[model samples]
Target: MTDRILLTCGEPAGIGPELAPLALESGVDFVWIGDPRHLPEGTAYHEVVAPSDPVPEGRLPVLPHDFAAPATPGRPDPANAPDVIEVIARAVDLIMRGESRAMTTLPISKQALKEGAGFGFPGHTEYLADLAGGVPVAMMLASTTVTPPCRVVPATIHIPLSQVPDALTDRVLEQAIRITHAALIRDFGIAAPRIAVAGLNPHAGEGGTIGHEEIRRFRPLLDRLRAEGMQIAGPLPADTMFHPPARSRYDAAICAYHDQALIPIKTLDFAGGVNVTLGLPFIRTSPDHGTAFDIAGQGRADPASTIAALRMARDMAANRA
Candidate 1:
């Protein structure tokens, strides 16, 4: 076990491999776990026997895992899908064993993994949750550069907008709120976290004119949590909850849907946003964006989010149990 963070190189065919060399600019102590061959040609790297090995300056420390095939820019090899899945599991094992202080994952293509390797999980969050004994978790996108950092958690994710009404049960919203609240205190070191809840419809149902979900279920849920001494505000209109004044009123915003939460933060800090999974046993953070197959091998891939993810992971790990 080492004090450094263990980074998993996700989707070799994507820009994940190339970003490692660029993320080094953040100067956070971390080692990458992936096939060295997948890295951009002419990259400086050294193979380490264990995760605890110290990395030399100007070189990436690779805990190598060979893939079934070579990676091509802008294209994923289904033949290497199982290998990609294995790398994530291996990284999980290292972290669970306390071999690293935290974990930072690059982006991955769920389609490729599912079609090639029969991946059953929805995405990294679900798979990681299953791996950690089916513990409940929430996805939070946290801005790294904003004046008052913007943090958001979408109660319902990866589901169609029409399906949101049926999917976002009182149980789901309550769990997301509990997880986000606990994580704000545990991982972020906030003594009294104020969570702002966003409504499911415009104008927060306009007092039941636009929609009833806000008045029917949302308000009741917030009332319960507030009675427990939680500083909760809203079932407010999602439209007006993200402006500077609204943002300053809460530590994190719990939105009704994915776009409601992500659109505001991604618009606020595109490059410096980091995706954090709340309620996980081990610390995990990732770049808010996905695999940029369009610029895989090109030198145009920016490392801002990756660096932010690393720094955020370090900060969270320092506050862990």
Candidate 2:
């Protein structure tokens, strides 16, 4: 059976409008959520139904979303932010209401969304979590790895390095571990996922020389996880965590800070990385990269990440089904 997915084009100014057609070929039933006006010329539009139908060749099925105002490619208007957010809300409703099985989100511009509209959260992960009634969530970046292959999650996300020390706590580390582990087994179909947790300080705090976060906070949580029979090993050196030889020991690397986790994965596969929100009521995946306003309408944006996200969403839905 084919899974029905709600595909949201995050921002009208981004490459989302261009990538819709490619996402349609990912071997799942997709109902696109965005303005029909934003769709490329010559694209056919279809209405949303109880049991959504598949798109035909030379046509794209779009579930129309309201845009507060008109959109110009590469020029983001805040007035349309509400409509952009509504697209997400509509997708969520479809899954919650059983109209769709999953959601694949295209990248949206946070600055444009906020300055143009009103949303309190930082990004998609936070917004999606709030939509699901405040279920705690973690963002994971998965991609093809060459030297050191691993799935990755940042313990503390969307925050500055100075705040990372204060945010590293026993509760945070343990929660991240539990969610990542369960997601691997239930969603990714990994029976026993080996998770590697990275330390906040250099050289695992250089044995408490560089920093005490590893000794005081993360280690205790890691110990507790071990006691729970989880296959976890970390408080490992952040610098060496992703090194080709050392990375094979684990399935996913949990980093202490944001950039520490993102840099390695983004460096490895910028265009193919998929940003997944684990522990959501419904499956939600997005391109790892963000809204590219620079080349919005020039037809120069690379849809690899969007294609990857669509493929991942299809696979995940099939796995769950």
Candidate 3:
């Protein structure tokens, strides 16, 4: 596996710039794509012409892209939004061209990008899917650095609570499960990964008292997959599925919606969670947390999630190889 990874510096006004320098100390080789001027003052960085250029210890390796305006912490500049998007595109291009093994990203502000550049996608996942020619992908928050090492995939994401039921269709759930299952085998090296499915309502809809989607939609799909020789379980109660004993039963937990999946993992290991995109042509991972604007330039942003993301990206790339 190539030692170099492409790192996109997200929103200049956020903690992304501050985290970049700290991530350099993680012992994972990466070439950061962003404007060096946006980085925290007194940061040590080496400007590199290519992703494969040598990087020295304690110094960030940067592939500079100049922003149109200076970045002030906690105050996003719209003029620099285009450049933020450009860095992500550049990272994607490098990965496609085989210049980098994988891509790890910092948090980006969708609102800032939309207001500035008329960015149309919902978030980075959708934008990346479009970049990869509209491939079907699932976001998996995998916690390898924490005990029990749980991984989760939400069946329906970025939708309102009312729309979650309709969005969690048979096709969508099956696709998410298939992608996650394949990723566990290929990217995580699990020979027979057990996946636990979480029900949408309380007590798994109390067997149809609270809701019927689990009975009408989830069960049939899970049964079909189980018959196909996949190690699948549940339509289980969402409340109890995340306990230690319960988590140990499965390699991954597939939930009905965004919060159902994310809440448990974040509760368990907020700092160490890594957001991995499953079924992408190339590997992509990011820190689970977002761009903390309030803490930007405060010199207090923790790099734990960023470090975990880089390590997970490296491991996934090696597994794919």
Q: What is the TM-score of each candidate against the true structure?
A: 0.98, 0.94, 0.98
Cα lDDT tens digits, model 3, 15-60, are: 9999998997688888888998899889899999888887776789
What would the per-residue lDDT of candidate 2 be over residues 1-321, giving only the tens digit for each residue? 237667898898888898887666665567788888887776666765543765565566787776877678889887888888988987887788887778999888888877877677899999999999999999999885355565899888988778887887778877888889988887888898999999887898988889888888877778878898898887898888777777888888888888999998888788788999998877889888877888888878777887788778877777766
TM-score of 2: 0.94
Model 2 steric clash pairs = 78-116
Model 1 compared with the native: what TM-score?
0.98
> How many residue pairs collide in each prediction?
0, 1, 0
| lDDT for 160 (candidate 2) | 78
Worst 10 residues of 2 by lDDT: 49-58
* Candidate with the larger TM-score of 1 and 3: 1
**Model 3 deviation from native, Cα RMSD in Å:** 1.1
- lDDT tens string, model 1, 1-321? 576888998999899998998988998888999999999989999999788887778999899999999999889999989998999999888989878868999999999999999999889999888888899999999999997889999999999899999999999999999999999999999989999998888898999999999889988889989999999998988888888888889999998899999999999999999999998899999999889998888888999999999999999988874
Lowest lDDT block of 10, candidate 3: 142-151
Model 1 Cα RMSD, Å? 0.9
